[model samples]
Target: MCNEGCLIADLELTFTVKGSHEGSQKILLDSDPSLRIIVFHCVINEQTRLDVTLPEELADGNETVKSGVLSFPLNSLPVQKEIIVEEEAGVVNKYNNRKIIANLSGDLDVRLGFNLCMEEQEFLRKRKKYVAAALKKILHLEEDLKEHEVPVVAITTTGGGTRSLTAMYGSLLGLQKLNLLDCISYIGGLSGTTWTMANLYEDANWSQKYLEDAIKEARKQVTKSKICCFSLDCLKYYYEDLKERTKEGHNTSFIDLWGLVIESMLHDKKDEHRLSDQRQTVDNGQNPLPIYVAINLKSGYSAQAFREWLEFTPYEVGLLKYGASIRAEHFGSEFFMGRLVKRLSETRICYMQGMWSSIFSIDVMYVWNLAADSEDFWCRWTRDRVTDIAEEPFLSMNPYEVDTCLFTPSSVLSSALRDVLTGRPTIAQYPNFIRGFQMHSKYLESEGFSTWKDTVIDSFPNKLMETADDELSLVDTGFFINTSYPPLLRSKREVDVILHLNYSGGSQTLPLDQIAKYISGQGIPFPKIEISEEDRENLKECYVFEDADSPQAPTVLFFPLVNDTFKKYKAPGVERTPEEMAEGKVDVSTILSPFTTREVCFSEENFDKLVKLTDYNVLNNEKLIIRALRLAVARRKQRKY
Candidate 1:
């Protein structure tokens, strides 16, 4: 199990000899008659050392018996050792040693390049075939077309806590009903939208037919009381599991507890599923490629600071900002000095989902309030202690600031309080984003790969040198751009149409504007989002934007979850008014709210209505959807010629 050139030296042993003596002759006994002999074999440096110990009784009182040490020259020792096994006694069933020899003679290629992994390349090949067939049917074309004629469309869902989860489901169902889902090549999601995507992918056969059932199950889970998270049994399980993870070199924190909460709402228990586990569901190329998004945390940057988006797919997980990529299976494994030091177990899907949708980390105060009201004294005391140290600050500020404060404690009591609140592990103890190089000098020499040499490295400070380790802490992408655009805009994908499913409670234009600004800043191409003042004043359910000059830019089909055209009622935010509450609308004012104390958990009827509203928002905009499809098809065909 050792790497090349690993050394081993020094050997010591103590043995008690036992044997019976023959008349007038001291005899070293063998495993027969009245004596037993045991032999020990030691293998080192391709040599063997054998030591035989005789029974001590044979030398107990014999004057002729004497103990002597035997030494063998390194060169004289045999290079091979023999193993004897007794089949009748069943001493040893089999014997074999596993040896792995690797050749590292050539110049190492460490350049960061932009290209899809083999799995994604194969997926695209099959997916394009599926897309072409679906498009032929959608366009009602009689003739079969070449693969290049099919468009690569990516539909991205926005982040808005649980609201987006429900709305995304409805929108997907609407697309399914129009037979448009089969035409999508990729589906990108961030925050709550990732939650829905993660759950949907859990079932391999998921489709529009199963959408209603999934929604019903999700509503059942979400509408349930938060009491389960604080129950003695649940608390015990969390305590034991977190302790185990901490012992195993994992970074455990209160955010992990949020993962537990999410697990309960989504999978009803701790799910051991990995992101790559979803590959089975999409291996046949029947479903759109699912990409979950997160952002890396800079040392001194605020959540609003524009950061690189870390994209996660079933095959690979990495950053498009620097064109760096790694196999998804190796995400949490240890990588040191441009090589893998160790390969740890793949991270659970719940943990990855928790990290991706960690906007819930900001709701510590609400969680504390819930804890304080719990019947368990331990829960109440723990919450009280946490609140006593930093209540007002955490309530007013974002979770990223709170995390920084937790790491940089000002006083002994604050340090103790931080330890208690963060589950006895420092921020550095947790697993983080993998780094390209462990040493700053090596990073400077190689520039973290040629693609990142001039651009990505210059954009950020030398925080790696300041920190003892090379990894970076990452959190939810909603902290930067709520909509996931960077991953979708990867040059390799060449997406021709991007369906933006906006479920934010804010102005409908805000998400699109933020995405457009972010992509422009990053030098990633996308159609300019030009929303007129009139359009903003009277927002519609869907809007289409195209870049006529740049046919390569994907046509953006923005669908903001709105109530103006679908229903008379307005879409509620985290909080709701009395009238809105009375109508049985969602009022998640006390649940997993992103930034405030107000949270909303929709009732069954209202949840159904919200689903219906989202469905109609897409279904009612059939003309616009058709027109966007036509434009994408025409543009794709034009490119083919």
Candidate 2:
């Protein structure tokens, strides 16, 4: 596919292309991701980027580059062309007539590293008042909680389709009621929980305001019929949305269609808000930073075999393993060689929400067998178009090195359109910003990429080349680990406490065990999450894990979705009356839960029960949560960064 970006037309190299006996003795006839038009840089300098715009008449079907400027449609690709130069050197360059487009240039928007982005850094400063007030009010601090002694506290939840989407509302409501939401530094999610985050973030001041109304709204959404999403009219709506996106040079796959359904389910009317728009909520740090999680899987590989962690915040969208990130607004825009070449319209947040929680995209059993550790989902997207993919799709390939295969992928939208025809699940690809860029030569041997002995492609030199490919195939993190633990564990985040709400709903396997194994392999400092098999048979409302071996391991307060003391009491000390007893008898069994992983509909009664149960679970454990927070504060005080 033709990259919809800019290129550098060199007049000095044009002479070499015309069989010149003498010139610079170097010919650089290649594709650059940032240029458009055939406007040649007649000056011999190959490194300069000129700020020249083509005249308006250039797009009037001009035959070729003329009057020192080449005009072509923005969507056209470059092809072999004979150009005559008016320069004294008699420069002439030959490239195919395929039209190439130029991208707007300025300072790059990407911020590369493991450190937090500047916006997030500025937010921490703004959040000091709210957190101190929360500590005093929630913990009843005898003295002020100093800003310097503050601990980075985070809350995380797992995915279980609609089950998670609704239960998360209850979980956050619980936090808000207890005044715990104000103390959190970050709130992260996987799959289903993202839908809840997207909904709440729209309110901007969601955390500062009372949460009952939001939970009530959630009740309405869950109780309503999801049948309309599959109605004939909805299909037409999806078709039109995708078609319009394609015309605007954006990619549209089956996932895009799924996003529209999610959009309708969450909002009755059109909500045109993008993720960047939510920056208003955290711009002054009134709320916890939101981190949405996904995993990057290679095109031809099984998720179990190769998967990398990806995170989306209102400030940025990036892959942590590569330590590479782009501005949140640049997510879908085309990028080549570390520069934003084509700025496609930022996708609506609904589309991103769909990608984060698209459990229906693949077979349920496949998701269960390959995964099923804790998270719940349906059809898993595994691409079968292996042969059709470019052999070294991660890196730029020369024409002669690879056969003249009928290359189909041009822009991401082109591949997305292909997915529509085949009816197979998509890889949720975006333009790889680091495409055409190489990793550190010693990346394999460095402590950065891998500290463990996994045989993953990124670990081996020959196989790691795939990291340089042109598109990123990001899928739900559930396809690998069932939780969103990796991003929070990044060392620079300096998190002291993690309130992990296990909304993933399945009962068989321990999700934390899966997370522990993955985190250990990545060499992150995390509390030892060891739960006995006996404990597995019977879950509790909450369990706290802390590091006895190392202080760096953040304390974890894990609350599984189990109806325990909430069924026995109205509050911590208040016993339930006979009529109220039934209110507490909410069933969250993996098999019998009204909020099952695949459950899309819930009665108002059951919905309230789920929300209340989750709320009670948090309320009952108030002392434990506070103790964890105090411990986190002490840990923060003793540790020196």
Give me the candidate number with maximum TM-score.
2
Question: Best candidate, lDDT-wise?
Answer: 2
What TM-score quantifies how close candidate 2 is to the native fold?
0.77
Instruction: Write the residue-wise lDDT of candidate 1 on 209-312 in tens digits.
Output: 55778878888865676656656566567667767766766666666766666776566677888888889777888789999988776565565643555789
- After superposing candidate 1 on the true structure, give the runs of residues whose Cα lies further than 4 Å from its correct spot: 1-4, 8-112, 303-306, 368-467, 568-600
The global C-alpha lDDT for each of the candidates, from Candidate 1 onward, is 0.62, 0.70
RMSD of each: 13.5, 13.5
Alpha-carbon lDDT of model 1: 0.62
Q: Relative to the unseen true structure, what is the Cα RMSD of model 1?
A: 13.5
Tell me how far the alpha carbon of residue 235 in candidate 2 is from the true structure, in angstroms, after superposition. 2.1
TM-score of each: 0.72, 0.77
Q: Specify the poorest-scoring 10-residue window by lDDT in model 2.
A: 15-24
